[model samples]
Target: MLFPVALALIVFATSVLSGVFGMAGGLVLLGALLALMPVAAAIAVHGAVQTVANGARAWFSRAYIDWRSLGYICAGIGIAAALLLALRYRPDLATVCIVIGLTPLLVWIPRRWLALDASRPLHGVLCGIVGGGLNLAVGVAGPSIDIFFIRTAIDRRRIIATKAAAQVVSHLAKVVFYGGLVQAMTGADWWLVLVAAPFAILGTQAGYLLLQRLTDQRFREWTRWIVSVIGIFYLGRGLTLLLGA
Candidate 1:
C-alpha cells in the first residue's frame, strides 16, 4: 500500500521536473523502479510510462513544435534505433554511468566555446542518432538534444514543444523494443502503469504551466543548472557502479 503511494509521488515529482527541464524524469524513475523491480522489467515500465507522459505533453504543446526539424530528427532516431536493435549491442551499465556522468562537462565546454550551426541537417541528424542511442541505454537523453536544439534560433516554447514531441517518439520506440525483449508483461507491470500514469499526466501539465511563466533568459539559466545537477548525479552513479561501491 505504502509502496504504490510512494512510487506515485516519485513519479509525479520526476515527471513534473522532466516536463519543466525537458529531461531527467527517466533517470529518476529508472533509479526508483530498479529498487522495486527487475532491471529489464523496470526499463520496460519506465519506457512505457514516459511515453505516455511525453505523448500527453507533446499534444498539449503541439502548436509550438517545429515540425520540419522534428521530422529530420525523428528520421535519424528511427534509423539509429533500428540499427542498434539489429546489431544486438547491449549497453554496458558501468560505461553508460561514466559517459552520462562526464557528458555534461564535455558538452559544456563545446557549448560555451563553439559557434553551433543548428541550421545544418547533418548536425541535427548526428545529434539525433547519438541522443536516441543514449535514450535506449540510460532512459534520459534530453541534455544532449537540448544542447543541440539550443544552437538553433527557435523560441523557448518551440524548443520545449519539439523536444517533448521528439521524446515521445523516442520513448515509444523504446517501449516497443523493450516489450519485445520482455516477452510477456507481468501483473506487477500492469499495476505499475496504472499507478504511475495519472501522476505522469499531472506532472506534464504542471511543467507546461511553469514554462509559460518563465522569461527566456531565466529558462535558459534554469536549464543549465538542471543539466549540471543531473550530470553530477549521473557521474556519481556511474563511478559508484564502476567502483562497485
Candidate 2:
C-alpha cells in the first residue's frame, strides 16, 4: 500500500516535470520503475503511464503542436520500432541506465555540430528514428529528443507540445514492442498504472499551468542543467551496479 502511494506520487510529480520541460519526467520515472521491477516490465509500465501522461499533455497543448513535424517523426518511429523488433533486443538495468546517462551529453554538444531543427522534415524523421530507438531500448528518449528541439527557434510551448505528441507515439511503440513483457505483468502492476493514470493527468495540467509562466530562455537553460544532473546520477548508478556485478 505504501509503495503504491509513493509510486503514484512519483508519477504525478514527474508528469509535472515533463509537462513543464517536455522531456525529463519520463527519464526520471523510468529510472524509478527500473529500480522496482525487471527491465521489460519497467519499460512496459513506464510506457503505459507515460502514454496517459503525455497524451494529456498533448491534448492540453494541442494548439501549439507541430502536426507536420509530428507526422515525419511518427514515420521514423515506425522504422525504428520495426528494426528493434527484428533484433529482439532486451536491455539490462545497467545498460539502460548507462544509455540514459549518456543521452544528456548530447545537449552539451556545440549546437554547430548538430544543429537539428525538428521543424524540417528530414530532421524530424531523424529525431523520430534516433529518439524512438532510444526510447524503446532504454524506456526514455527525452534527452535524445531534446537535442533536436533545444536549438530550434520554436518557442517553449511548441517544443513541449510537439515533443509530447511525438512521445505519445514513441511510448505506444515501446508498449507494443514489449507486448510480451506486458502480458507477463501481474495484476498488481496493472493496478499501479491504473492508480497513476489520473495523477498523471493532474500533474500534466499542473505543469502546463507553470510552463506558461516561464520564459523561453529559462526553459532551455533549466532543461540543460536538470537533465545533466540526472545524467550524472544515472551514470554513477550504472557504474556502481556494473562494478558490484
Candidate 3:
C-alpha cells in the first residue's frame, strides 16, 4: 500500500515537472522506476505513465503543436519500432541506465553540430527514428529529442508542445515494444499504471500552468543543468552496478 502510494506521488510530481520543463520529468521518473523494478517492467510502466502525461501535455498545448512535423516523426517512429521488434532486444538495468544517463549529453553538444530542426520534414523523421529507438531502449529520450528543437527558431511553448506530441508516439511505441513485443508487463503492472494515470494528468495541468510563468531563456538554461545533473547521477549508479555485476 505504501509502495503504491509512493509510486503515485512520484508519478504526480514527475508529470508536473514534465509539464513545465517538457522533458526532465520523464528522465527522473524512468530512473526512479528502474530503481524499483526490473528493467523491462520499469520501462513498460514508465511508458504507460508517460503516455498519459505527454498526451495530456500535447492536448494542452495543441494550439502550438507543429502537426506536420509530428506526422513525419511518427513515420520514423514506426520504422524504428519495427527494427527494434525485429531484433528482439532485451534490456538490463545497467545498460538501460547507462543509455539513459548518456542522453542528457545531447543537450551539451555544440549548437552548430545540432542544427537538426524538427520542423524540417527530414529532420523530423530523423528525430523520430533516433529518439524513438532510444526511448524504447532506455525508456526516455527527452534530451535526444530536445536537440532537434533547441536549434529551431520555435518558441518555448512550441518546443514543449511539439516535443510532447512526438513523445506521445515514442512513449506509446515503448509501451508496445516492452509491454507487448517483449511481453514484460503483468496484470499488476497494468493496475499500478492505471492508478497512476490520473495523478499524471493532474501534474501535467499544474505544470502547464507554471510553464506560462517561465521565460524562454530560463527554460532552456534550467533544462540543460537539471538533466545534466540527473544524467551524471545515473551514470555513476550504472557504472557502480556494472562493476559489481
Q: Give TM per candidate.
A: 0.90, 0.97, 0.96
CA-RMSD of model 3: 1.2
TM-score of candidate 2 versus the correct structure, residues matched by position: 0.97
* Ranking of models by TM-score: 2, 3, 1
Give lDDT: candidate 3, residue 168.
Answer: 90
Model 1 C-alpha lDDT per residue in residues 6-115, reported as the tens digit of each score? 98898899888777767766667776876676555666788888888888788889998888778777877888888888887565556666666665563455556655
Q: Which stretches of candidate 2 lie over 4 Å from their true place?
A: 182-184
Provide the lDDT at 74 for model 2.
Answer: 94
TM-score of 1: 0.90
Instruction: Return the clash pairs for model 1, or none.
Output: 101-235
Worst 10 residues of 3 by lDDT: 177-186
The better candidate by lDDT, 1 or 2, is 2
- Candidate 3 achieves a global lDDT of 0.88
